[model samples]
Target: MNGQMELVSARTVKGPDPVPDLAAVDRLVISNSGGKDSIAAMDEAVNLADEAGVRDRIVVLHIDLGRTPGGQSVEWPGTADLARRQAAYYGLPFEVRRLGKWPSLFHRIRARGQFPHLMTRFCTSEKRAAAHRFITEQVNALGVSGRPARIVHVMGFRAQESRARARRPALEVDHRASSGRRTVTQWYPVLRWSEAEVWQRIRDRGLPYHWAYDAGMSRLSCSLCVLASVPDLTCAAGLRPELAREYADLEEEMGVPFRRELSMAEVIRRAGDGA
Candidate 1:
């Protein structure tokens, strides 16, 4: 399904030739997910800001999903740490935020009696909302200080990643209002970048990426995301048998499978088929 990009008008003061002043922008927030695309996106954002002479206004933000019931991260190990290190490498401020206690994917599943499926991707909703909340708070704080708080939110979504993403515009004025004194805009710096270009950028910087990519995983988000490809699911299940078992148990308890066709146990079994 293709997602339509939302259209919103930029707020401007009335004048003979009223134009939104880009120089009045206060912050550029980059959503860093510790994935290859996110890393590339950050690099592109920094480069663009540098060209526009606004590099100093850039900040990197990451959201921690917290640990599961078994005290393990739902994301790949060291994902957050990698993001912090990358921020340091880029000489930018880094902030980590979460939705407070019980923020784990498993907690949500237990509460809903089901996992996040393709149709109802509660996981993405929760995480995205948390990031938005953080941005809103920052805007409000700047407003209280009587500053022009214009935020440019940079995301790593690429057009080539999916049909839905391909429909997104390179830039859009966010519909949601922040503080009255603040304006928020969304930008996709690398919206049209290819996967090869993404990896090339990472290598050009000599950066160490998340280990999951090295382990042959294509996309990096939730370790057992419902949108995971068969190979990704198999590899995740193989690498983290304990986590796979936990998911399997949850599936049994809910009397519903996370994947449409295969169970977690079946995915694991297939993972070891060739070996």
Candidate 2:
């Protein structure tokens, strides 16, 4: 909406990163994660819906992991609220799904005192992935949606965030989530954009987003969530000391180790310095 002002070097799956062209997809759903990448995808998804002459079909999917104890988890300033506002702005149906509040054995242990490592992402599976899968299955089985939906599952994943993410293709099927259902297609429009591009797009669009960044939060996942890096954990510890203590306690209780020395104290020390 910034008068279509060109980004310095905005790149999409297609060269030139044209906005109107992406609108050609039939069923375009912006997978809102309250993160800048997903927010950018929301903008593009709306743009695409308009161009494809299916503006009414546009929707936003906000999946809540449901167990964290933060404003961004199940509270007022949570991820779902951020998503709702964005969806309303786009005039699309915002489908907010909660993965539930009950914890499994592993989550209980991690939340109690055990630290989850790079190899283990139980929270994501129990929460994020579960909600996403259920929705897809429900929609695919609907009676009126002929031939299932040739949906473009627009996500906001940036390659520069990590080594593994760096390897993801700008355009590819989400094989990790796909169940051989050709009707469901995944598209990473913001794959090539840097972290700067992600924030720039959010600011330029004047879209509603989370304010966790103001509290020294980098990515808007769970507060003591395991995907955090050393600096991330450290920052969380400083901002939310109790959560840090809980994470440390959890790790000590579990007996398993984290790759980054498996010690939460290291994270706390590295917090402010961005280590």
TM-scores for every candidate against the unseen true structure: 0.87, 0.75
* lDDT by residue for model 2 (1-275), tens: 11112111244444544332333344556778777677887786677556657787667787765543322232214667787888888788887665554543235445545444567655555555655665575556543332333445677877787788778755554445544343445667777787888788788888887777877778876665566666666666677665566555556667654445546656666664566
Assess candidate 2 and give its TM-score to the true structure: 0.75
In candidate 1, what are the lDDT values of residues 1-275, reduced to their tens digit? 10111222243221221222334457788999899889888887786567668778788999888777788788888989999998888899999988644668788888888778778988888877787888887776665464446777888888887788888766666656454565677777678878998899899988668998888899998788788888999888888777888888888989988777878878878777832
Task: Please give the CA lDDT of all the candidate structures.
Answer: 0.76, 0.60
Residue 38 error, candidate 2, Å: 1.4
Candidate 1 residue 153 C-alpha distance from true site, Å: 0.9
Q: What is the lDDT of residue 133 in candidate 2?
A: 68
Model 2, position 150: C-alpha lDDT score: 45
